[model samples]
Structures are given as structure tokens and as C-alpha cells.
Target: MTESFAAARLPVRLTINPRQRQPPSVDLLAWIHRQPEYRPVVRQAGGGGGRPGFSDAVIIAVLAQGLLPGLFNLLQSWVDQQRTEASIRIQTGDTEVELQVSGRTDSARLLAQATEALRAAREPGPDTARELGAGAAREPGADAVD
Candidate 1:
């Protein structure tokens, strides 16, 4: 016998009520909350009438003036931000000797990995820029341009 698994994917449609106040109001939230497309999918995802999975599409539609591309742009911005943060760190060392690595942000996992790499190479260095390689590198002396 063999066992197999399938991933369930659903197309979600979301709509916001225009009659509602332009900025914030009940009619908009209600329209989004009562949209038919999400009901079945939420149920399938183990949510009942009381507890439903708020689909990303619904949230996007509500937040971005119903523009899907806007939602994607926002998400992309966040992703780009994380990647930028993950690259920023200061290094103190000689060109051929040892280097010290230091990052302002306290990401434990990232710090630990940097420490491990430093220890393995027996160098005192912060090679964050070098680690990024040429293609990924931002302009020289540029402070993590957004």
C-alpha cells in the first residue's frame, strides 16, 4: 500500500461595500464579513460560522481599495525589507587578518549563524556585504537603500 497527500487550494473572491463610508464604517466590514466566497473555504479550513479563517485575499481587498496589485506590492515591500535587514551588519577587522561582526537588530538565529561561520573560519570579521555577492550587493558605501 502507498500513501499520498494532496494540498487543497481554493480561489477566493472578496468584495467591499462602496456605499459604506469612504474611510471606515460598518457597511464595509459587514459586506466583507458576509461575502459568500469565503464562507465555504473557511469552513473547509476547520472554521465554523463563529470562527473563520480570514482569507488573505479578503484582507487585501478591504485594505487596498480593492486593488490586488496593491496588496502584492505591499507584501513585496515587506519581503524586500526582511532581506535588507538580514544583510545589514558591521564588520571590524583587518583586510587579511581577523574580523568582528555586529548587527544592530537582535535576530537570535541570524546572530548565531554569523557566530558559527566566524568561529569555523577562525576569523574576526563581519562579512555580511561579501556574503551578499556582487549581484545582490547594493551600491558601494550605500546604506541599505530601500
Candidate 2:
């Protein structure tokens, strides 16, 4: 199953929220479109709870399964460059894997933890529920939300 699975095959949605008092002047959607690597993957801006245009949160379209890995990598790079405190949420079906990242975040750890969280999310077992339940906690780089 893992062999046949492609990043494009896993449907994904990414929401990026900056954890700062003052919103940055940068336009995430526009920034993404400028990147040749990310332009195709970015579907649109997400409104989240409020009007799509009004909210600071920029939500992209649901990702193709095969695109998950690449997008995540791109996001990691983006985080490193921006060095902003932010929350990244990946949602699919009923599972939502969230990461609270800042300039101080450990990139290697963030990737590892996000991968683990995703794995657990995909394969829920007796222990899986506890690992992925609401209020799930983690070290500095990433955070999981049930």
C-alpha cells in the first residue's frame, strides 16, 4: 500500500496562520503563485471562519495525494525563510494535523513529527487515537490538533 501511495494521492488542505500581533504585509497567495514549484499546487485563498478575503489565514485547495510530500517540503522552506510564528494545519477527511512553527522551530524535528502525526492519522489503532486525539502535544517544532 505504501509503495502504491503517492503524495498526490493523499488529499490535503493547508492553512497558514501567522502568530503575530500585526499581520505581515506579505501576500501568501501571491507569493506562492510566484513560485514555479508551488503555483500549480495552490488552489486559492481560504476564508476559514470568516469571509475568505478578510481573514489573515490563507488556505490552499485540497492537495492531491501525490503532492503532499512536495508541498510540505516547500512549506518547510517557506517557514525557514519567513521565520514567522505560524500554525499550519493539514486537513483531510476527519484528520487534521497542525504544526505551530516559529523561527526557532527545529526543521528536522518538524518534518519527523509531522510525518509521524500523518502516519498515525492515516492508520488509527488502539494507540493511534490517543496519539492523535484532541490536545495532542509535541516538542517545539510541531503540534498536533485533534
Scored by Cα lDDT, where does model 2 land? 0.58
> Per-model C-alpha lDDT, please?
0.26, 0.58
Per-residue lDDT over 16-87 for candidate 2, one digit per residue giving the tens place of the 0 to 100 score:
664544455565566555667667768656455633333456556566655555555555555556655666
TM-score of each: 0.19, 0.65
Error of 2 at 139 (Å): 3.5
lDDT (Cα, tens digit) per residue for candidate 1, span 47-86? 2222132221222122211222332233223333333211
- lDDT score of residue 96 within candidate 2: 72
The candidate scoring highest on lDDT is 2
Q: What clash pairs does model 1 have?
A: 98-124, 99-124, 99-125, 100-124, 100-125
